[model samples]
Target: MTVNPLATPLSLPARPELTGGRPLGVLLLHGFSGSPASMKPWAHALAERGYAVEVPLLPGHGTRWQDLNKVAWTDWYAEADGALDRLRASTEAVVVGALSMGGSVALRLAEERGSDVAGLVLVNPFVSSTRTELKALPVLKRVVPSLKGVVNDIKKPGQDEVGYPRLPLRGLAAVLEMWQSVVPDLPKVTQPLLYFRSSVDHVIDPSSSPTVLGAVSSRDVEERILADSFHVATLDNDAPRIFEESAEFVARVTAS
Candidate 1:
């Protein structure tokens, strides 16, 4: 139930070309209750490798969880859509890399936008929520908007940090709704998918494993388990490996 609104809006750099032979474009999305700050290193690495990267700050995020109560899943999706459009304006094809809930958005975008997206990199995405967790959210959202600042303590990507301490219950509700909304459409995702699963993650449901692999229509599916990381694999001990695999995936997608 930890969901704190982002305090101040954060701005992400847009459409900077990698000074090589027209490197492909990459769009990155951070997880719920997270911000672009978490994905900066990954984006910078891609940028260094001659790939243009766009990591947008999701709406109601990077500011505060209270604002998140007013925002819906659509708002977050639109942000990612905007980032993808930015990538499209500069490159021939776009690759999407998303962490946690961000992964769901990336998959949905690929499903909806089709050939516009080249591939997907998913890190601990939430396709489904456990029943008990779902039932408790509404009460938590109302009784405790900021759950004692626990939500704020999450790990950020570029910083040695955990987010706010309170869990923004209303913010989490929106995320749960988003998960339910997108689960059915997973079969529509036809692009290549690279899943970076965290062996130690306790947040996402165990059901995610077979469901994701079975539902995705992608012909090229690669699943890598992070042996030493938690839910935030992008910033954990296995981060370097995640970067390498993601870079390789982007290269393959661009070449094809």
Candidate 2:
């Protein structure tokens, strides 16, 4: 499959820093169907702060919806976990910044990797769905390979999320299954968390924030409201706020 240029992975070494002699690191992850394009701006911001940054294109994405359908949730997690390992190899500490499904994968990384993940910066993270249709995904996916498009939920005019034009049912089911494993291990996510939630999101269900905030054992959890964005908050009007605040969050947490 021919991947779009926007889908290319980003790997930047942190600039020389005197803070602790070793530069810190960050792993930014995009949402379902979406590619690294959604994360570039934010990753650049952190990289500018002398932090090593990586934005890896997830498996089954940036090509076609049919490709995503054949992927399992485990594949996404493995890629994220590997990126985290790579970042840790050079930096003194690490923070994970994620959007939508990437947030779900981030949670699992925190759970399994423990304190190696210094902190979390999540934007419009997706967890459980209240949609009644999802309950029938097992049967529904077998009947149909896809549904309408779930990409480009940004309210910013002329913005293209550059994700699959259609939603793959089998792929959707795979991500939802990840919630089962993550939710149960939420208590293991004790890292300081900076969560960005869109007040007017069209793609993510309202139930998502509550499920995560209610279970994470983090003692330094802060939830900020994105008043002018949607599910793809990284590409929305409130993107600047996410970039600025998340950088601060990473600096503060990694310093501690």
Candidate 3:
């Protein structure tokens, strides 16, 4: 019996497209406080397109709350970077795809990888924000911990209600640290970039799109808008198009 690596205990409702053959190796990064489960479909699509997709569970993710509290930005980046490095070791060209905060890590990887990185596909990349709440008290971040395992009524996916109930303060601090580290280096990101923005994202500020558009030096940058989805567009109604466009972007960049 040939062991199918994609077959996890998640018993992910089999999407035929996910199985078949592999083409290019793609590193798929999920959003902050998100699990690799969200990127599963997109991975399947990319795999069906003959691409090998790697969706890594970032450190401090997909597990308990205290585990997340212990890790920092470097841990997350190292996990993502390790996945990319593994993909690069086996493939000629690697395309980095990320959602939200994951996009930040992916962009940083592209900048560091330079010519070796083929392109970038970013979904709702959180750049700078004018949101008064986050700016007002950066100190509040240190005091708060994730409310994930608490609030017994919280929905933990596959529930009737869908939303991220807990906001981890320490995690946000690490994210801010990462943003500060990456902002100055944004202009050096010359890899082809495809940025997808959600018009209705409540978690992300509307200003983020322009920040990314102006910051990234990618000569072939393209921006597309998702009208029906909120922050987690990858799992929303507009997901299929996002997957298609992303795969197409990678194909174009690698070919050129």
Residue 183, candidate 2: C-alpha displacement in angstroms: 0.7
Q: What would the TM-scores of all predictions be?
A: 0.86, 0.97, 0.84
Which parts of model 2 are misplaced by more than 4 Å? Answer: 18-20
Model 2 lDDT at residue 208: 82
Q: Write the per-residue lDDT of candidate 3 for residues 58-131, one digit (tens) a residue.
A: 77766544555678888888988888777777666778888888888887788787976788899888756786
**Candidate 1 deviant stretches above 4 angstroms:** 1-20, 148-162
Ranking the candidates on lDDT from highest down gives 2, 1, 3
Better-scoring candidate (lDDT), 2 or 3: 2
The CA lDDT of each predicted structure is 0.74, 0.89, 0.71
Cand. 2 Cα-lDDT: 0.89
Q: Considering every candidate listed, which one attains the maximal TM-score?
A: 2
lDDT of 1 by residue, 1-256 (tens): 3333332223333333543355478898887777776677787777667787887777877655577667888899998888788778867778999988788788789888999999999888877755685697777777777655423222334433234444567877887787776778888888999988877666666667677889888889988888777777777778788888898888888784
Which structure among the candidates has the greatest lDDT? 2
Candidate 3 shows a clash count of: 3
